[model samples]
Target: MPLLPGAEPYHRRGGPVGVLLCHGFTGAPQALRPWAEHLADAGLTVSVPLLPGHGTRWQDLRVTRWEDWYAELSRELLLLTEECERVFVAGLSMGGGLALRLAAEHGDRIAGVVVVNPSVRSDNPASVLLPVLRHLIPSRPGVVGDIARPDAVEIGYDRYPLNAAWSLARLWREIQRALPRVDQPLLLLRSPRDHVVSPANSALVLARISSIDVTERLCERSFHVATLDHDAELIFEETLEFVRRLAPDAKADDHQG
Candidate 1:
């Protein structure tokens, strides 16, 4: 499938400390490009893969399942771990779920995890109907560009593919079962007024995870896509700080300028 302009995956080689960034469902790498570049500029190797079924037409996503997306993330993560001495996984929304799953399965292999308004579970009534509705409906209105910036636009399909949503639900269920196994340091940033993912999702993961080091920050001005929203710089800086505290010898302080 032909990828949309500016939606290509990103990879940059920098230092022994590597970071793998994953975008949310229905979102392209475009959403997290700035964040990846910030880490790369700070001399950290970075990999941001465009998940399967994203950055293309909505119909194409309908045919894909969560496993396909998780496989792509896993591939990039393994590649980074092979070359870097230390590695971290950062994700937004559904990508956060994938990160959590990685931490669960890999244990201390993942140095830490950073998530922005992650969605593990939703109380939306529509979600309950996804299994049956997916068979009858091809798409529904999508929640894209939930940014606080007045003119910012997150270029993704306008329609939400029901079949893919059902697959996402499956991923969520699987991640829930493995939450107790995630012991890596966790940094969770959530927007107070997120219109897409609810705060409960983050709270649920926070309550269940066994990580001894966990920090939660409030993105006061941004929305769901906090990586690209008003608090973007804050997110980038905090991430660097988190990485530095863990890998003190890494040259991550260079990009703080």
Candidate 2:
């Protein structure tokens, strides 16, 4: 399948600390590209893989399951582990759920985790009908481009594939059950004005995770897609700081201007 313009995966080799960023469901790597570039410029190796069924048409996504997306991220993490001394995983929305799952399953292999406006559960009353709805309908209106900045755009499908969404719901339940196993340092950044995901998602994860070293910050000026919103620079700087604290040997100072 031909990838959408700007949806290409990104990989840059740099220092001993590697960061893997995962874009949200229906979203391509483009959504997180700037953030990856920021980290790469800071001298950290970074990888942003286009999840399976993404970066293409929504019809393609309907045929894919959540496991496919998780598998792609897991593969990228393994590659990073082979090349770097320390690795951190971060994601936006559903990708955040995947990051948490990685921390739970991989344990000490992941140095830390960062999530932006993660989606662990749906507040929509209609979600209960997904199993049946997915069989009857192919898609629903998309939940993309929820940025506070009017000019910022998120590259993703215009509709939500019902089948894929059901799979995501299952993934969330699995992550919730395994939250107790996530002991790595966690940085949870969220937007209070997010229109897509509910704030309770972050609260549930925070209350369940076993990590002792955890920090929560509010993106007061942004929306769901905070990476491309007003506090984008804040997310980039804070992430670098968090990684630096955890991996002191990381080459964060080498690329300073």
Candidate 3:
């Protein structure tokens, strides 16, 4: 499958502290490119890998599962850990769920976690029929590019793969069970008017996670894809600040001013 332009994986060598970024289901690295570049420019080693079946077509995603996606991210995280003294994981949407899972499984090895509109559970009416629908239907309307900015576009499959979505749901169940084990410092950025992930998802995560140092920010003007929406710059700046707070000794780019 040929990847879309700008959807290729991004990596930059910077300092001893690293950041691993993961994009949402159906989304490619293009969605996180700016964020990755910002962190990288701030002198942090950064990696944003395109998931196995993403950045191509919905058909590819239909054949893949959550394990495949997580495996790829886990590989990147492991590689980052080797060269960097400390590593933080940040993800959007389903990517956030994956990051939480890593924090649960890896524990103190991960320096912290940052998530934007992450989902561990869904209360949508369609969710109840996912088990049966996944077999009966292969695709549906995509939830990609749910940004408040009308001119912003997210490069992703036009269709949503039901089989892969079901796999995501199953992963969410396991992530919920492991939530209590996510003890790292956490930063959650949410969009109040998100049409896809409900605010209830954030509430559930805050209620379940054991992270004592949890911070929440509301992306009031953006929708589901807040990273590319009206709050994008704010998200970028806040995330950079989060990293700085975690490792005060790390030097930032003078050009940021």
Candidate 4:
């Protein structure tokens, strides 16, 4: 329940415009550090919280639910509002879903949003099987990958928690229902080869939304883990652009500085 050291407090300066960064499921702040550093360098306050039961061990995730994740992120958003006039939230995969949920619920308050490889619908056909395939997949203790960067965060168990995955499915359905209400500037950065989330899911949200400004950047090389992959720079630039537009006088030159 207490904040993990180097987890809650972000590396930032002078109460600049706030941007809360949430990492993917079963992942630690390591997955989001690059983005946070870039945002911080551009003079923004950034916080990338280690979600409940995350960053310690993969087993910790087994006991946590989606609500636990959302609650922590929402708390950070509320915190950002207290320090800065404009607030932006961004996430990857499961965190992406949470970001959108917050944006939808706090539509008018949020300045903008960015999401990468958002896992709204399972590309796995067995997801149709509901709370069963989760248990069927089984969680591997520590999975590693060959992402373009040297950074490697836990990929979570291969076996899905049927109930957890089922809950995610249900949450996605509800988020879909709330999509039209989000009219803030949004950047949906997705990977064409993301093995976890189908491109169609992003397409569906983009097509349905009526955001005052919307842009979809497609990463051609990386798989689902686009945050730490090659497209990360693109995500960073797009997010900088979003921040500049949403916050008064944030300027195009500010990001480069």
lDDT of 1 by residue, 75-107 (tens): 998899998999999999998989999989887
lDDT of 2 by residue, 1-257 (tens): 89999899999998999999999988889989989999998889999999999888999998889889989999999999999999999999998999999999999899999999988888888888999999999899898889989899999999988999899989988999989999999999999999999999999999999999999999999999999999999999999999999999774545642
200-248: candidate 4 lDDT, tens digit per residue: 7887778666687888888776777776787878888888887887786
Task: Compute the lDDT for candidate 4.
Answer: 0.72
User: What are the RMSDs of all candidates, in order?
Assistant: 1.6, 1.2, 1.6, 3.5
Q: TM-scores across all candidates?
A: 0.96, 0.98, 0.96, 0.84
Off by over 4 Å in 4: 1-13, 132-160, 251-257
How far is 50's C-alpha from truth in model 2 (Å)?
0.4
Q: Go through the candidates in order and give the clash count of each.
A: 0, 0, 0, 6
Worst 10 residues of 3 by lDDT: 248-257
lDDT of each: 0.90, 0.92, 0.89, 0.72
Query: Which candidate comes out best when scored by TM-score?
Result: 2
Top-scoring candidate (lDDT)? 2
